[model samples]
Target: MRKRLLTEVEGVVAAPVERVWRALLDDRPAYEMTTELGDHTVAYQGGWWYRGEWSVTAHPEGARVVLRVYNVADRLGWGVPLANRFFVGFGARTRQTFAEGLTALGERLGCPSRLLP
Candidate 1:
């Protein structure tokens, strides 16, 4: 069987793109990025850093957001396979994580959710 490479999940947030971005990186170390307003996108590549993007668009009620996350970069280093098998187990429980994240984000942002897959 072929090994899984990436795990992607999409969701919509009721808040504005800027709000979503701010909430996403909240309570974390300071970081900066140059991004557009509506179609905002960001990437963090510190050893396969979830590497998620929150795509935002105008909606009648609120902005629609898509959160995509998965392993990115540094996949071919020494002992990488061993590490993935031993510690990371990448792609494992990705769907659950995505669903829980969106639900919590919706509640936190005061955006009603529609159940993520």
Candidate 2:
């Protein structure tokens, strides 16, 4: 039951943290992709192998959003890597998707946003 790290990406929003937080609450992702919601974090646990979590934190410019994927398999955890090997560029694709999401969120919030390196 180890929550192994998979990949992580981050973005910065040029708006108040509260505004960003409220927007996250008002606009959640697809229901099937979500497993937990908290004051500053949203988590998605899919099947028995994958978990993606997003969190927001105060930043000097405004707020910072981070998305982290994990290997949360309850069994056959060793196969997670073997299975993922077939999905080449999975981490890159995940980062790109998260960056696009941040851009879209910025657009919706009428603020500037940029993905972190």
Candidate 3:
């Protein structure tokens, strides 16, 4: 079976929900956000792949921009194998990396970003 992992990130945007929603739904900005380093690739409902290393699917629920990211890097390639293994396997490092990616995605979507404490 595929490793099933799903996460939800919620935040309040200073702008109106519709405005924020439009910004996120725009193809160009959405594409840019995913292709940028450290940002996951967001393949829209029926969009094509090839923008980024990983795949992402975006859905808007009212004011919330809910994204599902797939094929995230456990360990980026071309590095010290041992070190990469240690870090990626560690819970703290993994969580931090994922959090950072989510924060970046939120910022690109014009939302103030924060990690849940």
RMSD of each: 5.8, 1.5, 8.9
lDDT of 3 at 68: 42
Residues 9-110 of candidate 1 have per-residue lDDT tens digits of 666677776776677656232554333233355544344333545555565555555555544444554444456566665555665666687688778988
Which ten contiguous residues of candidate 1 have the minimum total lDDT? 27-36
Per-residue C-alpha lDDT of model 2 across residues 21-108, encoded as one tens digit per residue = 8887676655576468887998888877899888999999899998999998888998988888899888999989988889988999
What is each predicted model's overall lDDT from 0 to 1? 0.56, 0.87, 0.41
Per residue, candidate 3 scores C-alpha lDDT tens digits across 24-115 of 44534433343442332334222221112233333343243344433333344223333346656543554566467556656776566444
Report residue 92 deviation for candidate 2 (angstroms). 0.3
Instruction: State the lDDT at 86 in candidate 1.
Output: 68
Each model's TM-score, in the order given? 0.54, 0.91, 0.33
TM-score of 2: 0.91
> Which candidate gets the maximum lDDT versus the true structure?
2
C-alpha positional error of residue 95 in candidate 1 after TM-score superposition, expressed in Å: 2.1
Give residue 26's error in model 1 in angstroms. 2.3
